[model samples]
Target chain A: MISKKLAATAVLALSALLAAGCGSTKDAARPAAGGAGAEAGRAGVVLPLLTSPFWQAYNNYVPRMAKELGVETLPTVNSNSDPAQQVTDINNLVTQGVKGIVVSPLDSAAIVAGLRQAENKGIPVVAVDVAPESGKVFMIVRANNRAYGEKACKHIGDQVKKGKVVQIQGDLASVNGRERSEAFNQCMKANYPDIKVLEIPAEWKSDVAAAKLDGLLNANPDVKGIYLQAGGVYLAPTLQTLKSKGMLRPAGDDKHIVIVSNDGIPQEFDAIRKGEIDATVSQPADAYARYGLFYVKAAMEGKTFRPGPTDHDSEIVKLPNGLLEDQLAAPLVTKENVDDKALWGNSVK
Target chain B: MRRLRELALVPALVALIVLGAFVNENFLSYANIISILGSSAALAMVVLAESLILITGKIDLSLESVVGIAPALGALVVIPAASAGFGLELPTAVGLALIVVVGALVGAFNGFLVVKLRLNAFIVSLAMLIVLRGLLVGATKGKTLFDMPEPFFALATTTFLGIPISVWLAAAAFGVAGFFLRYHRLGRALYAIGGNPAAARAAGIRVDRVLLGVFVVAGALSGLGGLIQTGYVGAINANQGANMIFMVMAAAVVGGIAMDGGRGTMSGALTGVLLLGVVTNLLTLAQVSSFWIQSIQGAIILVALMIARVTTGRAQE
Candidate 1:
């Protein structure tokens, strides 16, 4: 009888937790269906993860861009940063009989199976943010991540001329993280020979970055500059750590650590205004959404394109994997251009 | 003998400190030691939570998720909608209380499933972990909350006697838990239950009630750990507690806690947390190639295990 009573109380608590869990996953996983305009050309978008503000911004833009481009899109399904789940989400979208699909892959190699399944279903897949290691996609919508590293190097190198600088990197196992780290190190070596780059493999985790960075700063307190790979995660912690140590001097101050970062989020803009950080390479979350739908729509229309410049400023380059990637422009945002009405971060809030 | 086993990791920790000093001149500085202690505070709290659950012969993987969702939910109701909060503007104290309450509630639910339903503890907690993680994503809409009230960041920011309060809290938690497990009657009852539930019940111990209480307290501890983590990180993100379970388990198992239950000490677990902390700090100070850090860290952990086997005079089996 006591067990039975306990079971009833358990049911009550489980339902409350499950009730909240049910609402969000349903909103995320449910494909848009039961439309009166069934023939209005529907596409499915599968997000890699929504944990990062960059992805959240891209998620917010999807429906608006789809409407602006005059295409009906199913509400996006978040894979929640699971490669296997991303594949399952794609198969489900194909089963729903959507005409086209847009996906930001969680893994470059694992996503090939999903792309292949979509191909077998005769649904054109537009890959965004991350390109598949090997797959046939209609178009890859992304910024040049290597250039993100190079731009940061130039920004910091121009000012700090000679000293130890730190680069708080993302997960090295990821292609984006590897490319950025390699390019930044190479740029520092070639352009600013006098500067030394100390790298922290932060794995896109803020706490790990902050802790290791604290240790790093302790060892080398006179470090001149810092390049944060992902500002969305690292910015606050980096600033917090620097402030605690009395190292977060303003830009014009003699002891300020000239900071360059990736991801031009609103927080980064505010930091730039306050002179906590100097510049950032906006990863073009808005363009990724706008053009991910734009290309998927073109594919649905049975359109074809060659590798070159498009009406939009982005260039289409054919990869050795027999895939085409439309490299979008990721502008460098500093104090001067931080308030520009054109930057996505400025427009987000 | 058991007390000596708990101190088994002390030699390994000293050796690592010696190695760290050799790697760099600044490695022995007062500032570096304080930084390592402060940063390891959250992990130490989590290790304590997991150790409590382990001591009871039941594992709770959901403690990791509790570390995230508890604090996220608390912050969500108080901050403005611009910060992705619900805009209730609840009192900061209430928000803090809500974090502990949510954690305790999750623990209670897990206890009900495991004890009342006779479900497998592993599967039930694993499922709860996933569910709680999803709830966090949904509650915060995957947006990182930055504009928390000042008190939310207090545990990490406030310092006493030249050390952060977070470090002191973790140390106190371990001390209290260690003393209870060693000397208190109820703490001895936990060992009796975990060693053999049927035998323990035959001895007139209220096994079910005590087990349920442990689960509840473990959950509350994890929630408090989450609160401390938020202050340490300076913000709360949906992925706050992601992958923390592995570290918690590592610290507990390495510290001499038996996975099968009924044998471990708080000192041993504290040693495990310190070992991992010192190794990470040493590698960074040595300027070891970042690519090689993970491999070297794994190797050191294996060596630590071998040392534990020698010190305890028994294999980990």
Candidate 2:
């Protein structure tokens, strides 16, 4: 009887634990206010992707900012990474009488219709991280991806005098990848005429990048430099491959290879300091959240706004062109000042 | 004749190896071979677990989700101490023990639905698959769980006696599964159940009990697979075993395991896994485009199934 009771209690405890586990941090990040408008109480804000650290930080800061502003924010499910899902979420928020909606578009094209739907329902929509191609979005807050790409390529050019350079690109379908690759290619063509850029698609995967690197090495044995756009998660395996082939080294080492990657993830910063990589471009994740919320707030006020440009800070403030662009400036991280915490601290946060 | 039939997969595997060697010299390198086996080990474990269920005339579409969930659960137990929360950091042994217990519980749940509720295995396991996958996504917030214990990582990357730890683990799992299906009365009972459920019942075998046992074994092995996989990749993601069900099923079918069930060996399953791994390795070594890999995998499976079916038909005639 005692054993039976014990087992029953254990099962009860486990079931409770499972139930608790089901409530994700993303759900907890929602605004606590009950209704939509400021007068109606608190409102909910949903993000498109929760898997990425950048998005998670976005989810975290949005609610924290909402709380400080005395507003309620609720995060809805956009887990599918589908524009239809985002559209549905926007419509649902509108039905719930939400004062405003902040969305990071899954597909720039598909979200245009969704934004129009929200607009039709009189719901203000602020685009975050990525902007819709349609001019309907109130504001787009994001890092300057093209400048980031240019800075990354320029850094890589500084490392190698001339030879074959392999560009490890992210998913080409993504707006960030396309813009970054374009900027990198533009910089390469303008400055490094002797350097040959072989764009090898890594698909934003470490193993894939490593495999591609192996093939690239086998095909082009004398490749002197690599420009990686996706940061450490997709760089580790390639770095290991290079290490195995005796290509990576510190300042005094016999062989030196230039690596300029993006998304200054913690490990990438460590790599830069250790000289395994030459430099990296840091995307301000916290700024994405802070500015993303500012855009939502501005939209909610029924203020006239222009889409921001990719090169300058728009935040909630008016821009020079009175247009809000989705891309922001890319901060460069090099071996000379990798220890500067202020520059790369936002990425780790 | 049974022994020869069992060894039939060997020739195809040998032929593939020779073809690979001729196609690419790098395919014969030690590094490439080790990499192939290492990559295949996780999939091999999934196939082994599915083989047990197939032996009992049941299919588990839920094996994929089970693989996804186990590592998430294991990660929860392992990563929290180092990261988010402060708790007693359990060793790999403890983590594995918890994983097995959780797996068995899930298996028993599946068994209960099939036996007591009398749901179709196909429908029941598929539902479980979706439910578990949803739960995994929600629990991890779709982010990967990293920073696993060092020992667990070692289980994936380390070698013992010049053999990868994963290869050894696969071999041991196969040996144990083969022995269970051969010597044990319960194992024999499973085969009887798969061969004919009505006859099994008439022969005084409790079909429900045997099925419950089969599911328990399948789930336990899936748990083991999850543990190995987490160690293999050093992280767990929501889609860790997504699209793996088709691969597991194909490997089993190609290994002479009939779709109708009661017709395969653990040894054949291993050979099927190794054969597929070798083909993939060869393609990679030859610098084949990624787009061709999936099509080639499909073609190999079709050819293997044809050969298996023809050979089986001839023996029956």
Candidate 3:
């Protein structure tokens, strides 16, 4: 009886594992051979991870934008935020004989080995969102993350003017986190001399943001404004905490704490519409996909870019690492332009 | 001696309370106290789960992933495809049940591997953690599920006698588990099994079945923990409960639960969870530099563990 039961349990466990394997592998699996663009040269797109809405939006736009640009691309492989897996994915893509690769690296320093391998294989790479610390790439398509901090600061500063404002920061270890935090602090010091910025480094976790924001509110009940570093994670928790404390007054109310956030997720736009937040810097997800494929396609055809102006109201700058970056336009969206048809968040159903 | 072990973390918690009082006057206020408990609720549940498993000479590192994927899968069933779900649009009640059920299923599978299949528990759980985390990212496609039905958020939003329901639920879980472990016959058998499975089997304690039951229960607890977290955060993101096992393990170890097995109390684990929560809230309220906050948290945990060691008359096993 014991042996029979043990065999049954083993079979059950194996089947369950197989079921989960099937369910999750559908997205990560390489597409079947001879698809619509089999004649066209293929580009491999590797995502850092899909845990955040910003990356998800970019992922959704990749195929559509690729079709529009007539670029044949493989089904994007997600590194799932593992630097080692990212390197492995790059190797796998190279082995598949892709003409070029587009990748958004999770860690700048750790991505070097992957880039080096692709370089050795002579497959050009177009990096999006995160620029690798040391590597060769066809182009880096990203917005000024520091400007994200400054724009948030100006919006909150213009409204709050003098009293204390809490800036819920992301992890200090990350480049985006450090840049946004330092830029926001410097801007506050330069532009609004009297405004006190209370900083809470939340490490990009919503619960941490909510807990820290809650405790901060308890001590500084008079905080006049709030700046959330990443609205994708922080928006709901911050709003819910404020609402629970009965401090989430409408935008025009005297007790309202002016809030500015980053990321252009639909929820942020909805919050702006409901007067829960004042403004957000709409990080251009559509532009990222457009240019990620655009440049990769260009690189595949032997076209090169230089440090200068671009036609899309942006600039291509050469970094200290000798890699060229096309800084895309990331506009600040307020209630006035929250409903703009061109903004990617507005288009998401 | 066991009683002393259970009470070892109390002094550290008390010291933290005193420090919090001095650091910020609002630290002891009723509202701030509730806030601390509310924030610690999810961590407390996962700690409780780990404590149960640790007492059985096992660990479930995948409990952290359970806290993410369970709710993500649960919410996915009720949401439409346009919202990044499978468009099942299942009833909210079924969706909620699915969270705990999925968690229990994962636990059951883990138990099968570690118990019947005789695989190494640590490696099995670690692999499960990676697999479940990947499943969460794939299933959600990296989108945060927002605008869920009101019942989903009601647990964290609603209050009973001025306390969030999640806090109440966590407190009840610790209470019930502590009572059972201390006084119940079957619970004592679990201790015996963890302490020495060979001896436990010789004593006819049904060692394997009890161990399997413990794993399933732990998984269910983890699932409920995720549900409460979903309500607390107001939405489910693919990254929920990411890297939380470190905190859960730290709290369990600091609370005097033995990694080698067969020792510790639910009260000890609960205090461990509270100590971390209090320190985090105090640091934030004190306006400590964001960079120093993590370093300070680590130092405090080390000091607490030292205190536990001294009081227990030995280092934790």
Q: What is the interface RMSD of each candidate, in Å?
A: 0.9, 4.6, 1.1
lDDT of 3 at A216: 84
The docking category that best describes candidate 3 is medium
| Residue B79, model 3, lDDT | 85
What's the lDDT of the predicted structure labeled candidate 2? 0.70
Tens digits of per-residue lDDT, candidate 2, B241-298, equal 7667887887786776666777778888888888777765565555555435557757
DockQ of candidates 1 onward, in order?
A: 0.53, 0.12, 0.53
Best by TM-score: 1
How do all models score by TM-score? 0.93, 0.77, 0.91
- Collision count for each candidate, in order: 0, 20, 1
Pairs with steric clashes in candidate 1: none
For model 1, residues B1-317, the per-residue Cα lDDT tens digits are: 76778888887888888988988888889889988998899999989989988888999999999999999989998898887899898999999999999999999999888888889899999999999999998899888999999888888878999898999999999999999999999999888887899999999999888888888998999998999899888889899999999999999999988898888889999999999998888888787787888999999999988877787787673
> Model 1 over residues A67-135: C-alpha lDDT tens digits?
899989999999988899999999899878898999999889999999977776667889998889886
Please identify which of the two predictions, 2 or 3, would achieve the higher DockQ against the true structure.
3
Ranking by TM-score: 1, 3, 2
Whole-structure CA lDDT of model 1? 0.90
The positional error of residue A345 in candidate 1, measured at the CA in angstroms, is 1.5
